[model samples]
Target: MAAEALKSDFGGKAHIALNDPKLRANFRRAMDGLMTKRAAQFADADEWNALRARGAAVRARALAQLPELLERLEARCQANGIQVHWAETTAEANAIVLGILQAAGAKRVIKGKSMVTEEMHLNAHLEAHGIAAVESDLGEYIIQLAGEAPSHIVMPCIHKNKVEIAELFADKIEGQAYTENVDELTAAARKALRGRFADADAGISGVNFAVAETGTLVLIENEGNGRLSTTLPPLHIAVTGIEKVLEKLEDVPPLLSLLPRSATGQPITTYVNMITSPRKAGEKDGPKAVHLVLLDNGRSRVYGDSELSDTLRCIRCAACMNHCPVYTRVGGHTYTFTYPGPIGKILTPQLEGLDCAGDQPHASTLCRACADVCPVQIPIPDLLVRLRTEAVHPSATAGVKGGGSAQSLSESLGWRGYTAMYGSPLIYRVVTRLMGLFGNWVPASAPMLKQWTSVRTKPKFAAKSLHQLAREKGFSHD
Candidate 1:
């Protein structure tokens, strides 16, 4: 695992993702099934909307008092025998985790599916330092062996069909043969990872929700890996973004009820683990030392911006991405970040900077389908537009938005020309007349103009402009 993770080079990723036919088919099948399941679970529309609104309110309130809540959580975790560490950036988070592992004298680590680790490029870092970090989640294991990142948040290998997975297992796993059976594939991965679980010196996991009232980390998953990762090892380290915190234990239920259902359309996932602390005095199982790393990584800055703070409310349910036309076409990897789809567009610029992530906000069609399905009721489309504005006009942000290297003299000039023509009726009429008269004569060598003519011939423009014809026909009240 080289540190050169899929490169945050956004300019060419969408083009590559769009052209991959096999990936497109895989997404189409996966998305259709997920949408069907989601629809079935929410047969009563009113109940769904009510729950969604509650989730939004709870998240907004928690974020409003985040600083106080985090301090409270740290104090409470210490009271429960759990050590908590704060990391302001990905590098700081990685360094803290590595230092903890080294202090425990751990060389082999087993992991549950955690996107924060992916964001930090933790596996590559650990590999470079001679630590073997093994991914135990089936889909995570599949992609790890393939040397590829997870294409979807909920379904990591959603871009790969059973056939592709079968092929990957046959090629990567020793003595394994090719088979497209789903159960067999899962069984193969389970067998391969079970040994790592028993032998791992330490375990790593991700937190879905952190309840500040009781100082507990909540995890939701279908498979049993998350449970094993926390309890089986001598030491456990949980990593997550600071935004995952909740104010009280009671606050977790409303968000939890919606989280699994929103994410995978199940009434409840098979496994939900709540870790309040490490093994106490005489506990037979659970880690001897439990640590929680709360990562800021530009999140505190995002929280400071009133317009973008709503982005922090996301529970990683990913309902927005499921309904997004752009995400459906290009898949997650096209965004070239750990969090992809609608969430990625707003969050990536903050974490990776606009210089690397500038193209994501522009990829949207502004269809607003994502906003409609978001369980937390985050106004994703509005945030997207604000990000675009920040990119094109950085000074407007007042440093509230992330980095932006989007200033372009030529594009700005083109917008000025559009305004000049469209803002005045006489200029608009003249411009239309000139284009209608000589647009075809402008040679095909003019590439930008050729784009317009390619779909529309010069003769398509009528002798009379649309305005003149409308006036003649008495359709214009003006």
Candidate 2:
């Protein structure tokens, strides 16, 4: 499944998603509700702006000294008795995790919601090695059961409505009957997973904020599943991108203030678990050993660019996805990557090469709605434009992976021709006059118009040029 994702067929998948009425309806309803709720949370314009600014500043400060902070984080965590591991790539990270689980003689593992693990394809890797890993988050569990990827960052199974889920449960879950009652479905899921939490050999979770000053791994969730996933088992392993580290504990408040409100429009999540170290000498419930795996996975390449480094400031609040018009219509699956929407458009191509995901940069409408709502004030639209340019005429020094892979001889020639006509006044006048004289004679079946006319009308040209009209009106002199 992950191998197939490397091939770029975004246009084909987007076409299918656009035609699926069920998918479109699901996304429309979900996105609308999320947008409404988030707006209500930020009803006060003054407060919202102030909070967003602070959040952006906090993230920027951490990223500016990311290397120093990471070293500090490792030192502090080791001092606190939490072992830290580093991986340069997903393959290495998977190997490190598999070795840890094997060393502990673990066979069954329960996991909390973590996009980093998804990026690594960690579940598939573990299963291949004869270890069973179960997603404990309700939304994550539903998708896992159905053999699907998450349709949204915050809501994994948002693409599945209650009736669909009820049918799935009835078919998949033992001793379960088909029912649309939300509470009944919830109870059934609880009954199924309740035993796994207690019996699992190990727990794995993602860190929302890894504080360097105190070496704390913070996770926030409404369900107690994250708490259980980290605490119940004797061995706990936390994984996150290196970009998730923060400079200090004080930097957490502004981000915490923005994450939930921007994600699901809540004042705060039900649970915010902070793990300073493994179980202390006197503690009874926490894990006996805790390991932190900070995975670089192309993050350093992204960090090298002064402009693209802003991408690291993302808190994964996913506010950009919630407000994206393109995402609302096509849904997450169209991107064919772990992340979907405005963030994915800029992020995927950078992590994966442009050769693999170059088409993703062209998927946006450049609406700037994502930038406006971003908690960290990332210039999403500007980044999209930069990526688009990189795909064709990339910077020689930038060294973006697979840069210029999307360039084409015909496209380059066409642009050169356009430049030539516009650069010379005599050629421009001749071209415009000729276009006005015979443009309407061109057929919709014309080769140049085929793709454009497939979904739109062929434009009709006036017999008189705008230049001629301006001259007649005494508005111009030649």
Candidate 3:
């Protein structure tokens, strides 16, 4: 498909995704495998519930004191010799990173997998400024080479199969032969990225958790790339949302216990990197200068609402996506945002404004599958309904960004008529009788029924009212 053919809206993109057999098969296979793995990891129901409760409590505590914890984190990080920068928006975040790189005269950077960077569009910003940012995470590297956004948060290239990847590697990687062998393909990528890690002027990454008490930036990955990106270069810069802050280092274990098991069904990842500060004078093999960029990017708005604050409890586990029927079918690209699936449906609208992403809330089937699988137990279905209500009837305090932007006069009037008919007994009876007289006469092509009838049969209305039948059958209303 041409770039111009791609649609920004959810419906258009979903239509394209649903029709593509290859894409559907790729996502179905990936989702099923992930679901099975995650289910196996949490086989004991009692253990799963207890751990979920503990993790939720830990996140709730952190978010409750978010402001104080963030301030304390900055102080502790500064005391530990880690420079901290704060940005209210993605643009500011980009500029802060650029200034840090420019100050160090860094023209090349190797990156660890960070969804926040994707949200910031950091690579494009840096490239436009004449700096090169190379993604070191294998999945990230693959999609970056293909000039595509991540289709899944935990697995960026989940939309493509090995054969497509073989083609991509063959075409994009110089002198690389087409091979569907997973190990060989991985080796090829490692060979290509080894030089970038050693020669890059700086490294950039995303923090999984930032402990306020000890001032540590924690990142977990199955691959060693995250470690190399943060340690191999002389300069390292980490960017993350402010919501990632935790009140204490002790709170890490409960969340960590659930994160990997929920994400990829692993007991533990291969590498867990924790950076307390920059390299000391005698210290070797670490960045000499370390910087942390804390980005708000509308997270504060999400945090402001007590009901919506649950959204921040997410630990970036893709378990919700893996279990979501809608997401599994349409894939992440259909969401057309940095985050996708149930979490994205709620998070994207608040971050980007409902005027841009109002349709996302309505995309769900409200199956509650996402909520059931969420590691933190976020009530995704409830939040979707909340956003839907905010669209037509905005809060008086201007709570949600672009609230009420989806409202339409015709829809509002139709709803009003429905309310009136349902509220009045006489009106209901008269409308039902009239409908029984002429409802079936309404054609499938009628303006209101056309879209509804596309996949479903037109509902036939009875010629006689139920009340009339009851009277004829000698049944009293009592």
Q: By TM-score, rank the candidates, best first.
A: 3, 2, 1
Candidate 3 lDDT over 118-210, as tens digits, reads: 998999999999999999999999999999999999999999999989999999999999999999999999999999999999999999999
Best by the TM-score measure? 3
Instruction: Give TM-scores for every candidate, taking all chains together and pairing residue i with residue i.
Output: 0.92, 0.96, 0.96
Model 1: per-residue lDDT, tens digit, 405-437? Answer: 787776788789899999998899898989788
- The sequence of per-residue lDDT tens digits that candidate 2 reaches over residues 1-478 is 4643576678899899999999889888989999999999999999999999999999999999999999999999999999999999999899999999999999999999999999999999999999999999999999999999998888999998999999999999999999999999999989999999999999999999999999999999999999999999999999999999999899999899999999999999999999999998887789999999999988999898888778888988888998998889889988888989989888888998899999888888898999999989999899889988998988876677889998988778878989999999999999889889988888998875686798798888998988899889889664
Q: What is the C-alpha lDDT of each candidate?
A: 0.87, 0.92, 0.93
How far does residue 117 in candidate 2 sit from its true spot (Å)? 0.4
Worst 10 residues of 3 by lDDT: 1-10
Would you list the clashing residue pairs of candidate 2?
Answer: none
**Candidates 1 and 3: which is better by TM-score?**
3
Clashing pairs in 1: none
